[model samples]
Target: MSLTAVETLNREFLEIRCRILDLAAMLDRLERSDDTVADDPRLKRIHEAIDLLTKSASRNSSSDRAEQVQLTFSRPYDSAWLQNLKVRPR
Candidate 1:
């Protein structure tokens, strides 16, 4: 017999999780390399989008998190400061 709705969803969830883990590992390797092509607009946008997505995911998860965290930031910052945002060269 074919899988039920729940089974299909569960399979997809696992697949997505595995893909995310693989992506994470690749990104980790890229982080160590100095040959990053920051000049590529597509790469730039992808990096920005992923950063936002990760922060959004973290914020949502943190809300229901058991261990409370009170993050403080300087002027012109809020919950966004709670995220580990990229630090551009100053």
Candidate 2:
């Protein structure tokens, strides 16, 4: 890729990100409302989009963090067996 290619992509990428966030926030509000949105196809598609984005992000993450998963323990001491506990940049 060249500089011009990047320049062309930057605005589009930012716009897409903004739109996705806005959509997700709207869906979040709907999910929190009293109405039942679980069976909604639109809601399902939103969830799927988020999952796909998360997996893609994980793939691009630094080596210091887990590639595709985040782990948690039941109790504080239950995680003692773990060794690596590094934080990665957002």
Candidate 3:
């Protein structure tokens, strides 16, 4: 039998909480560092992903949050990616 929403949340709550705490700690560390990340594309993508999650949660949409987040960090596939990276075929 499939688990209900409450049952699923009960099973996963602690893991979810831990992950949020980890993300918060990482953000804190970054804030405390002297290195600048405001202009970094990767950090911009992280901000976009966070905004996506916040918006989706507020809407309570049934979209796949994990897939959305993953896409936020992914790039379009390039047919000449290997050539672009200058990887030699073995």
Please report the candidate that would top lDDT against the real structure.
3
Candidate 3: lDDT over CA atoms? 0.92
lDDT of each: 0.62, 0.62, 0.92
Question: Per-prediction count of colliding residue pairs?
Answer: 0, 0, 0
Candidate 3's clash total is 0
Q: After superposing candidate 1 on the true structure, give the runs of residues whose Cα lies further than 4 Å from its correct spot.
A: 1-6, 48-90
lDDT of 3 by residue, 1-90 (tens): 999999999999999999999999998998889887888999899999999999999999847999999989998789998999899999
Looking at model 1, residue 19 earns an lDDT score of 82
Per-residue lDDT of model 1, residues 7-85, tens digit only: 9878799887898899789778877888886687655655665665567677775443222211211144455654547
The candidate that achieves the highest TM-score relative to the unseen native structure: 3
What is the TM-score of candidate 1? 0.40
| TM, every model | 0.40, 0.43, 0.86
Tell me the lDDT of candidate 1: 0.62
Clashing pairs in 3: none
lDDT for residue 43 in candidate 3, whole number 0-100: 87
| Model 3: lDDT of residue 80 | 98
